[model samples]
Target: MARFLTLLVLLLAIDRAFACKPEQHFNANFSDTADQLSGTEAGNLATWVKSLQNDYSNHDLFVISSYVKNASQPGDSAERRTKWLKDFLVAAGEDENSIVSAGTQVYKPENFFYTKITPSTLIIEFVPGCPNPCCLGANPVKEK
Candidate 1:
Protein backbone atom coordinates (compact mmCIF):
# COMPACT_ATOMS: atom_id res chain seq x y z
CA MET A 1 0.00 0.00 0.00
CA ALA A 2 2.82 2.37 0.81
CA ARG A 3 4.47 1.70 -2.54
CA PHE A 4 1.19 2.39 -4.36
CA LEU A 5 0.78 5.66 -2.50
CA THR A 6 4.33 6.73 -3.42
CA LEU A 7 3.65 6.02 -7.06
CA LEU A 8 0.50 8.10 -6.99
CA VAL A 9 2.34 11.02 -5.48
CA LEU A 10 5.09 10.80 -8.08
CA LEU A 11 2.56 10.58 -10.89
CA LEU A 12 0.72 13.64 -9.61
CA ALA A 13 3.92 15.61 -9.38
CA ILE A 14 4.91 14.65 -12.88
CA ASP A 15 1.53 15.70 -14.20
CA ARG A 16 1.84 19.08 -12.57
CA ALA A 17 5.36 19.56 -13.87
CA PHE A 18 4.32 18.85 -17.43
CA ALA A 19 1.10 20.79 -17.29
CA CYS A 20 0.81 23.70 -19.73
CA LYS A 21 -1.44 26.70 -19.71
CA PRO A 22 -4.71 26.35 -21.56
CA GLU A 23 -5.31 28.44 -24.65
CA GLN A 24 -7.74 31.29 -24.02
CA HIS A 25 -9.64 32.58 -27.01
CA PHE A 26 -12.59 34.94 -27.24
CA ASN A 27 -14.32 36.21 -30.37
CA ALA A 28 -16.98 38.77 -31.29
CA ASN A 29 -18.65 39.17 -34.65
CA PHE A 30 -20.21 42.23 -36.17
CA SER A 31 -21.51 43.54 -39.46
CA ASP A 32 -19.28 44.92 -42.22
CA THR A 33 -19.69 48.52 -41.11
CA ALA A 34 -20.06 47.92 -37.42
CA ASP A 35 -17.57 49.51 -35.06
CA GLN A 36 -18.98 48.76 -31.66
CA LEU A 37 -19.04 45.75 -29.40
CA SER A 38 -22.34 44.44 -28.15
CA GLY A 39 -23.09 44.76 -24.46
CA THR A 40 -23.13 41.02 -23.86
CA GLU A 41 -19.97 40.46 -25.83
CA ALA A 42 -18.15 43.23 -24.07
CA GLY A 43 -19.27 41.96 -20.69
CA ASN A 44 -18.25 38.40 -21.48
CA LEU A 45 -14.84 39.50 -22.75
CA ALA A 46 -14.28 41.64 -19.68
CA THR A 47 -15.16 38.73 -17.41
CA TRP A 48 -12.83 36.42 -19.28
CA VAL A 49 -10.02 38.94 -19.15
CA LYS A 50 -10.47 39.34 -15.43
CA SER A 51 -10.36 35.59 -14.97
CA LEU A 52 -7.20 35.29 -17.02
CA GLN A 53 -5.54 38.02 -14.99
CA ASN A 54 -6.38 36.19 -11.81
CA ASP A 55 -5.36 32.73 -12.99
CA TYR A 56 -2.22 33.29 -15.06
CA SER A 57 1.06 35.15 -14.92
CA ASN A 58 3.18 36.77 -17.64
CA HIS A 59 0.28 36.56 -20.04
CA ASP A 60 -0.70 38.91 -22.87
CA LEU A 61 -3.99 39.79 -24.45
CA PHE A 62 -4.16 40.46 -28.19
CA VAL A 63 -7.13 41.98 -29.94
CA ILE A 64 -7.14 41.35 -33.66
CA SER A 65 -9.89 42.82 -35.76
CA SER A 66 -10.66 40.97 -38.95
CA TYR A 67 -12.25 42.84 -41.81
CA VAL A 68 -13.79 41.64 -45.01
CA LYS A 69 -11.22 40.98 -47.69
CA ASN A 70 -12.80 43.12 -50.39
CA ALA A 71 -15.10 45.59 -48.79
CA SER A 72 -15.39 49.22 -49.78
CA GLN A 73 -15.41 51.58 -46.88
CA PRO A 74 -15.16 55.35 -46.55
CA GLY A 75 -12.84 55.18 -43.62
CA ASP A 76 -10.60 52.68 -41.81
CA SER A 77 -13.34 50.81 -40.03
CA ALA A 78 -10.89 48.22 -38.74
CA GLU A 79 -9.24 50.86 -36.61
CA ARG A 80 -12.54 51.80 -35.11
CA ARG A 81 -13.30 48.18 -34.30
CA THR A 82 -9.92 47.70 -32.68
CA LYS A 83 -10.42 50.77 -30.57
CA TRP A 84 -13.80 49.51 -29.43
CA LEU A 85 -12.32 46.20 -28.37
CA LYS A 86 -9.51 47.84 -26.45
CA ASP A 87 -11.96 50.12 -24.72
CA PHE A 88 -14.03 47.14 -23.70
CA LEU A 89 -10.93 45.50 -22.29
CA VAL A 90 -10.20 48.57 -20.24
CA ALA A 91 -13.77 48.66 -18.96
CA ALA A 92 -13.34 45.05 -17.88
CA GLY A 93 -10.55 46.09 -15.51
CA GLU A 94 -7.68 45.28 -17.80
CA ASP A 95 -4.94 47.83 -17.62
CA GLU A 96 -3.10 49.20 -20.60
CA ASN A 97 -0.09 47.07 -19.71
CA SER A 98 -1.99 43.82 -20.13
CA ILE A 99 -2.92 44.60 -23.68
CA VAL A 100 -0.10 43.36 -25.92
CA SER A 101 -1.47 44.67 -29.18
CA ALA A 102 -4.63 45.78 -30.91
CA GLY A 103 -4.21 45.38 -34.64
CA THR A 104 -6.22 44.78 -37.78
CA GLN A 105 -6.06 41.96 -40.28
CA VAL A 106 -7.83 41.01 -43.44
CA TYR A 107 -9.99 37.91 -43.28
CA LYS A 108 -9.34 35.34 -45.89
CA PRO A 109 -10.66 31.80 -46.11
CA GLU A 110 -7.17 30.38 -46.52
CA ASN A 111 -5.86 32.11 -43.40
CA PHE A 112 -8.23 30.25 -41.15
CA PHE A 113 -6.46 28.64 -38.23
CA TYR A 114 -7.90 28.77 -34.76
CA THR A 115 -10.46 31.32 -35.94
CA LYS A 116 -13.06 31.61 -38.66
CA ILE A 117 -13.21 34.70 -40.82
CA THR A 118 -16.35 36.74 -40.91
CA PRO A 119 -17.27 40.26 -42.02
CA SER A 120 -16.01 41.81 -38.83
CA THR A 121 -14.74 39.56 -36.05
CA LEU A 122 -12.70 40.60 -33.07
CA ILE A 123 -10.40 37.86 -31.82
CA ILE A 124 -9.10 38.10 -28.32
CA GLU A 125 -6.12 35.85 -27.73
CA PHE A 126 -4.73 35.36 -24.26
CA VAL A 127 -1.13 34.26 -24.63
CA PRO A 128 0.85 32.90 -21.71
CA GLY A 129 4.50 33.31 -20.91
CA CYS A 130 5.42 30.18 -22.80
CA PRO A 131 3.01 29.88 -25.68
CA ASN A 132 4.88 27.04 -27.36
CA PRO A 133 3.07 24.38 -25.36
CA CYS A 134 -0.35 25.93 -25.63
CA CYS A 135 -2.73 23.54 -27.37
CA LEU A 136 0.24 21.16 -27.47
CA GLY A 137 1.20 22.55 -30.87
CA ALA A 138 -2.17 21.51 -32.31
CA ASN A 139 -3.59 24.96 -32.91
CA PRO A 140 -3.14 25.14 -36.66
CA VAL A 141 -3.05 21.40 -37.20
CA LYS A 142 -5.43 18.59 -36.42
CA GLU A 143 -4.82 16.85 -33.13
CA LYS A 144 -3.72 13.29 -33.64
Candidate 2:
Protein backbone atom coordinates (compact mmCIF):
# COMPACT_ATOMS: atom_id res chain seq x y z
CA MET A 1 0.00 0.00 0.00
CA ALA A 2 2.79 2.44 0.81
CA ARG A 3 4.58 1.62 -2.44
CA PHE A 4 1.36 2.25 -4.41
CA LEU A 5 0.86 5.60 -2.73
CA THR A 6 4.43 6.60 -3.54
CA LEU A 7 3.97 5.63 -7.16
CA LEU A 8 0.74 7.65 -7.39
CA VAL A 9 2.48 10.71 -5.98
CA LEU A 10 5.35 10.33 -8.43
CA LEU A 11 2.96 10.11 -11.35
CA LEU A 12 1.14 13.26 -10.30
CA ALA A 13 4.40 15.16 -9.97
CA ILE A 14 5.55 14.07 -13.41
CA ASP A 15 2.29 15.19 -15.00
CA ARG A 16 2.57 18.61 -13.38
CA ALA A 17 6.19 19.03 -14.48
CA PHE A 18 5.30 18.65 -18.15
CA ALA A 19 1.97 20.50 -18.05
CA CYS A 20 1.66 23.27 -20.66
CA LYS A 21 0.10 26.05 -18.68
CA PRO A 22 0.48 29.37 -20.52
CA GLU A 23 0.97 32.54 -18.53
CA GLN A 24 -1.22 35.40 -19.77
CA HIS A 25 0.88 38.54 -20.10
CA PHE A 26 -1.40 40.99 -21.84
CA ASN A 27 -5.10 41.63 -22.55
CA ALA A 28 -6.69 44.73 -23.97
CA ASN A 29 -8.95 46.09 -26.70
CA PHE A 30 -7.45 47.10 -30.04
CA SER A 31 -8.69 49.58 -32.59
CA ASP A 32 -10.01 48.71 -36.03
CA THR A 33 -6.74 49.74 -37.61
CA ALA A 34 -4.10 47.09 -36.96
CA ASP A 35 -1.43 49.61 -35.97
CA GLN A 36 -3.72 51.72 -33.86
CA LEU A 37 -2.39 50.75 -30.49
CA SER A 38 -2.39 53.85 -28.28
CA GLY A 39 0.85 55.41 -27.07
CA THR A 40 0.42 54.05 -23.58
CA GLU A 41 -0.59 50.64 -24.87
CA ALA A 42 2.34 50.48 -27.23
CA GLY A 43 4.76 51.53 -24.54
CA ASN A 44 3.42 48.92 -22.17
CA LEU A 45 3.55 46.19 -24.79
CA ALA A 46 7.13 47.05 -25.75
CA THR A 47 8.21 46.98 -22.15
CA TRP A 48 6.58 43.61 -21.54
CA VAL A 49 8.09 42.09 -24.64
CA LYS A 50 11.53 43.37 -23.74
CA SER A 51 11.19 42.00 -20.25
CA LEU A 52 10.11 38.63 -21.58
CA GLN A 53 13.06 38.50 -23.92
CA ASN A 54 15.49 39.44 -21.17
CA ASP A 55 14.00 37.65 -18.16
CA TYR A 56 12.43 34.53 -19.64
CA SER A 57 14.66 34.12 -22.66
CA ASN A 58 14.10 30.38 -22.85
CA HIS A 59 10.29 30.51 -23.21
CA ASP A 60 8.22 31.13 -26.33
CA LEU A 61 5.50 33.76 -26.53
CA PHE A 62 1.95 33.05 -27.69
CA VAL A 63 -0.45 35.77 -28.75
CA ILE A 64 -4.18 35.47 -29.34
CA SER A 65 -6.59 38.05 -30.71
CA SER A 66 -10.31 37.54 -30.27
CA TYR A 67 -13.07 39.63 -31.79
CA VAL A 68 -16.84 39.57 -31.84
CA LYS A 69 -18.36 39.68 -35.31
CA ASN A 70 -21.05 42.18 -34.39
CA ALA A 71 -18.73 44.51 -32.53
CA SER A 72 -16.25 45.10 -35.34
CA GLN A 73 -16.53 46.92 -38.64
CA PRO A 74 -17.48 45.00 -41.80
CA GLY A 75 -13.92 44.85 -43.11
CA ASP A 76 -12.06 44.27 -39.85
CA SER A 77 -10.69 40.80 -39.09
CA ALA A 78 -9.09 39.11 -36.08
CA GLU A 79 -6.24 37.76 -38.17
CA ARG A 80 -5.13 41.23 -39.20
CA ARG A 81 -5.01 42.43 -35.63
CA THR A 82 -3.07 39.37 -34.51
CA LYS A 83 -0.57 39.65 -37.33
CA TRP A 84 -0.02 43.31 -36.61
CA LEU A 85 0.81 42.53 -33.02
CA LYS A 86 3.26 39.83 -34.04
CA ASP A 87 4.97 42.22 -36.41
CA PHE A 88 5.13 44.90 -33.77
CA LEU A 89 6.78 42.49 -31.35
CA VAL A 90 9.33 41.42 -33.92
CA ALA A 91 10.17 45.03 -34.72
CA ALA A 92 10.60 45.62 -31.02
CA GLY A 93 13.44 43.03 -30.96
CA GLU A 94 11.64 39.81 -30.01
CA ASP A 95 12.67 36.86 -32.14
CA GLU A 96 10.13 36.27 -34.91
CA ASN A 97 10.36 32.49 -34.71
CA SER A 98 9.87 32.42 -30.94
CA ILE A 99 6.42 34.04 -31.13
CA VAL A 100 3.14 32.44 -32.17
CA SER A 101 -0.23 34.06 -32.81
CA ALA A 102 -3.85 33.08 -33.32
CA GLY A 103 -6.96 35.02 -34.18
CA THR A 104 -10.37 33.76 -33.05
CA GLN A 105 -13.94 34.84 -33.56
CA VAL A 106 -16.14 34.84 -30.50
CA TYR A 107 -19.87 34.23 -30.60
CA LYS A 108 -22.18 35.88 -28.16
CA PRO A 109 -25.87 35.32 -27.65
CA GLU A 110 -28.21 38.32 -27.84
CA ASN A 111 -30.47 37.05 -25.08
CA PHE A 112 -31.07 39.09 -21.94
CA PHE A 113 -28.91 36.74 -19.90
CA TYR A 114 -25.84 37.84 -21.90
CA THR A 115 -26.35 41.44 -22.93
CA LYS A 116 -22.83 42.75 -22.68
CA ILE A 117 -20.60 41.79 -25.57
CA THR A 118 -16.84 41.80 -25.26
CA PRO A 119 -14.89 44.05 -27.58
CA SER A 120 -11.98 43.07 -29.81
CA THR A 121 -9.23 41.98 -27.45
CA LEU A 122 -5.64 40.79 -27.71
CA ILE A 123 -4.09 38.29 -25.31
CA ILE A 124 -0.42 37.35 -24.97
CA GLU A 125 0.74 34.18 -23.30
CA PHE A 126 4.11 32.68 -22.38
CA VAL A 127 4.45 29.08 -23.49
CA PRO A 128 7.18 27.04 -21.84
CA GLY A 129 6.91 23.73 -23.69
CA CYS A 130 4.85 21.66 -26.08
CA PRO A 131 1.45 20.91 -24.60
CA ASN A 132 1.49 17.28 -25.71
CA PRO A 133 4.31 14.79 -25.28
CA CYS A 134 3.75 13.34 -28.73
CA CYS A 135 4.71 16.70 -30.28
CA LEU A 136 7.62 17.29 -27.96
CA GLY A 137 10.05 18.21 -30.71
CA ALA A 138 7.54 20.32 -32.61
CA ASN A 139 6.28 23.42 -30.90
CA PRO A 140 2.91 23.91 -32.50
CA VAL A 141 0.95 26.88 -31.26
CA LYS A 142 -2.77 26.34 -30.84
CA GLU A 143 -5.41 28.56 -29.30
CA LYS A 144 -5.45 28.32 -25.56
Query: TM-score for all predictions?
Result: 0.59, 0.62
Put down candidate 1 lDDT per residue, 35-85, tens digits, no spaces.
886777667776777777666654655545445566454337777777777
Question: Which segments of candidate 2 are over 4 A away from where they belong?
Answer: 1-5, 18-22, 31-35, 71-77, 107-117, 129-144
Model 1 superposed RMSD (Cα): 8.5
* RMSD for each of the candidates: 8.5, 6.8
lDDT agreement of model 1 with the native: 0.64
* Backbone clash count, each prediction separately: 0, 0
Candidate 2 TM-score to native: 0.62
lDDT by residue (90-144, candidate 2, tens digit) is 7987678867756565545542244333455566665544443223346544432
Model 1 off-target regions past 4 Å?
Answer: 1-22, 61-65, 71-75, 113-116, 129-144
Local accuracy by lDDT, each model:
0.64, 0.62
Clashing pairs in 1: none
